[model samples]
Target: MFGPQVFLRLFVRINQDLWPWQVLAVVAAIGIPVLLFRQKRFERRLAVGLMAVAWAVSGYGFLVGYFGPINWPAVWFGWAFVAQGVLLAAAMFSGGVREAALPSGRFVALWLIVVCGLPWLAVAESGQWQALALFGIAPGTTAAAGALIVAVITGPWRWLYLPLLVLWSLFSAAMFWVLQAWWLLVAPMATLFLVGAGSWLSPRTAQSPD
Candidate 1:
């Protein structure tokens, strides 16, 4: 629960600290849906890879490097992110993830990707260049994207990471709570609940007739 200025500073400092990598983060986020929509064979892996980047960076870079200086709680948050990042990496080869969508929900998944990944940094405060909230650079934003991506993973353990992503969203909201950032909390929670519901209601892929 910090102030708006503080939130801005946190975001600005993080963006500054993660300069070049921030570009990579953007590319990765954009690349995911592109790959998925194109029906590329590597889309699932790409999604996981991007998620790994977001989790790892938000944990080690922001939580430790930036947020820790201001928030005492960030250290453990950092470790949590780091652990999740590790899990995401492991997920690639472990049969932990599969193609997104269960047939009827691909649209929803893509919608979430765009909403969470690339919204402008400071839509309300455009004059304040330093107050931007880019995806790869900000933990809350990154976690939002990560949660959405992991939510659709289709495997026996497809839902395995869902809880963690939800928890991360809550954790992000807590950070906003301290800062009284109602704007930030709304998106993540709404997305989390909506996606969870949609995924639950979505039809599974039909099997071919024998």
Candidate 2:
């Protein structure tokens, strides 16, 4: 495994190379939850579509194309990200949004913090603005947001998407631990908490109906 400096350098390079694309990542990251929060069918479909694009772009574009040369394992993760994109595509077309619900206020607020704060966390940890880890372009933020996205929607099929996101959360948490980026752990830990609570609440919410 690479050391913290190498990891930081990789992130720096990625941020620099990706350039203005991070803006799109932010837009997609924010747009997804915003659309889902609306809880309308067409909006939900658009959210899922954007989510699928995010996963695919993050996986293939970042992991395989950019990070893979540095870390061979990331190539596998890249493919898995594409697979997740496929799963989301299936969910969107197969009527998975039918029972989607507004996330609890706590979920919404936590997600807001995660999505809004994560990119800058890289800057705080590395002391370099170029180390920004934007959502859709970075695995940590993407998986974190993906977990929360799955949590807000109701259905067993959504569980298909959770494992990879949680796996990436745990995996990235380890990487952050190795880097002594303790604050970065918040992204993964929050993802776990929100997803667990969302899973517990979603079924009950489905049965009860507001």
Candidate 3:
């Protein structure tokens, strides 16, 4: 396994290589929750599509193309992310998902926190803004935010999108613990909170937007 220093360095390289896309990713991340909050069918569908793009890009672009060289397991994770993207794409058309309305503000607030706060945690840990783990590009934020998004929605397939994200949350949390990057645990904690909230909310929810 790679050490913290190498892991941090890997992030720096990823940020540099991804360049302006990082800016776009953050921008899109900020907008996604707002779109969801609108509760309009078109905007909600757009948000899901964007979420799919985030997963697919981070999967192949970050995991397979970059992180895979150092961590072999990430290659398989990359493929899994790609599969998740496909699943989400299918989910956009799911009957319950497409027509559902977002009736709660709590989930949106949590989603906003994960999407907005996660990238800066990398900057805080590494003391380099270049190391920022933007939402759409970075696996940590992507999975964390994506999990929160899926948790609040109503659909038979809603559960399908969550396993990989939950696994990634646990996996990344373990990685952070190993590195003693204690602060970065926020990413995983946020994800776990979503799982908990979903457990509580999914049962009560009849049909709601993700």
Supply every candidate's count of residue pairs whose N, Cα or C atoms clash at under 3 angstroms: 5, 0, 1
Report every candidate's CA lDDT. Answer: 0.63, 0.77, 0.78
For model 3, residues 107-190, the per-residue Cα lDDT tens digits are 667777777788888888888888878787888888888876664456667777778877888888987998999878888888
Candidate 1 lDDT over residue span 2-105, tens digit each: 56676566666666666666677667766755654545546667667777877887788878888787777887778788887777777776756655444435
Clashing pairs in 1: 1-178, 1-179, 2-178, 2-179, 121-133
Show model 3 residue runs off by greater than 4 Å. 96-98, 198-210
Ranking by TM-score: 3, 2, 1
Tell me model 3's lDDT, rounded to 2 decimals: 0.78
Clashing pairs in 3: 101-209
Worst 10 residues of 1 by lDDT: 117-126
Candidate 2: deviation at residue 109, Å? 1.2
What's the lDDT for residue 29 in model 3?
83
Candidate 2: segments with Cα more than 4 A from true spot: 152-154, 200-210
Q: Name the better of 1 and 3 by TM-score.
A: 3
- Residue 21, model 2, lDDT: 71
Candidate 2's residue-wise lDDT over 63-178, tens digit each?
A: 89877887898899999999998888888888875454653576667667777788777778778888877778877777777776665454767778788877887887887887
